[model samples]
Target: MRIKETIYKWIFTIFAFASLLFLVGIVVVLFKEGLPIFKHVKLVAFLFGKSWYPTYEPAEYGILPLIMGSVWVTVGAVLVSVPLGVGSALYLDELASYKQKAILKPIIEILASIPSIVFGFFGMVIVAPLIQRIFKLPVGLCALTASIILGVMAIPTICSLAEDALSYVPRSFREASFALGANRWQTLTKVVVPAAGSGVSTSIILGVSRIVGETMTVLMVSGGAAMIPVSFFQPVRPMTATIAAEMGEAAMGSAHYHALFAIGLILFLVTLVFNIIAELISRRFRIKLGLNR
Candidate 1:
């Protein structure tokens, strides 16, 4: 037994270290390839300049439009996904009948398993035309269409994690609130939900990470316009979309190739920040809930 334990520990330790090594190697390569773009353009200009004509004469390389496109789509996705996801979680965890849970939960899980490319087709073939008709727009492919599709993609993640969070709230909390004469709604709102705040927040943040990093769906439905977005109806290209669309065609060792790597670096850092924030929130919640000392 002692020998087995020691072997297991060493095996897991090696795996953990191997994963860390790969992460570090990726960071080093990203920096080595991406840092060259800074030599060609100032950091401020690269970040804030609006133009993104990498193949034009003199080749502009500002990424502000790309950044804003990502922000707009992400924000729109959050708006669409968060409320619906939370509501779904509340229903499944607090209000649903066993039969409903049996039916709906599996359906949602299946929804999550569907491929991104399939979702892209749905957006293009169905949602886009519907949106265009409702808004009387000339084109169906726009930020709004992309955002709605991404939001749908994010829903299963947010709903599952949030439902799990709600399930973790101690039954004693609800009973205590009831003993104090609180109604079901009151207990749910002021007791159970608050107890699960960190988990719900983590879910939302993770959903946002998915929304921002999405490539294929956004590339297909976001109209492929590399311009600053003024309206939700405008066509815009996010950083992920731009990278997915152009990286193959960019010449190796050229400025464009380096710029794509730079975009990836920024995206990596952004997702890293979201993950860190989620960890901090989850840790704080665990401490508050007395799950950790």
Candidate 2:
């Protein structure tokens, strides 16, 4: 028994170490390839320059438009998803009976499991045409369309995580609040949600991260325009879309290839920051709740 246990522990430890080793290898490769772009274009020019005419005679490589595209879509997605997601979570945790909860939770998980390309196809054939007809726009493919799609995609993630966070609040907390004369609504708002604030916040941040990293749906529905977006109605191209659309055509050792890697590096950093923040929040909350000894 002892020998078997020792072997199982060593196997698990090796798997864990392999995962870390792969992560470090990816980071090193990303930096090595991405850093070369600076030799062709100055850092500030590549980051903030207005034009992205990489194929033009002068070969401008500014990524400001791509950055703004991601920002606009992410912000719009947050606005559309946060309220609905959080509300669904609250309803599931506090209002729903056992039967309703069981049915809805599985539906949410299924929604999360649906392929991204399916969402893109749906957006193109269904949502885009609807938006164009409703708004009387020249085209339906724009940041708004991408935002709506990504928002729907993010909903399952937010709802699932937030519901789990709410479930983690001790039953005694609700009983105490009731004994203090708080009604269900007051107890939920003042006591329960506050107790799960860290977890709720973590869920939200992770949802935003998912939005930021999305590629196919945005590429299909976001009009594929490589210009800074001034309104939701305007077409925009996010960094991920740019990479996906152009990487195949860029030469292996060209500046354009390095530039795509640079974009990936920026995206990697942004995702890392969001994850770190979520982890910190969850850890602090766990320690405060005495769940971590």
Whole-model lDDT per candidate:
0.94, 0.94
**Per-residue C-alpha lDDT of model 2 across residues 1-293, encoded as one tens digit per residue:** 99999999999999999999998999999999999999999999999988898788878899999999999999999998888899999999999999999999889978888888999999999999999999999999999999999999999999999999888888999999999999999999999999998989999999999999999999999998989999999999999999999998999979999999999999999999999999999998787666775
What's the TM-score of each model vs. the native?
0.94, 0.95
Cα deviation of 287, candidate 2, in Å: 1.9
Colliding residue pairs in candidate 2:
none
Stretches off by above 4 angstroms in model 2 are: 1-16
List, residue by residue over 120-177, the lDDT tens digit for candidate 1.
9999999999999999999999999999999989999899888888888989999999
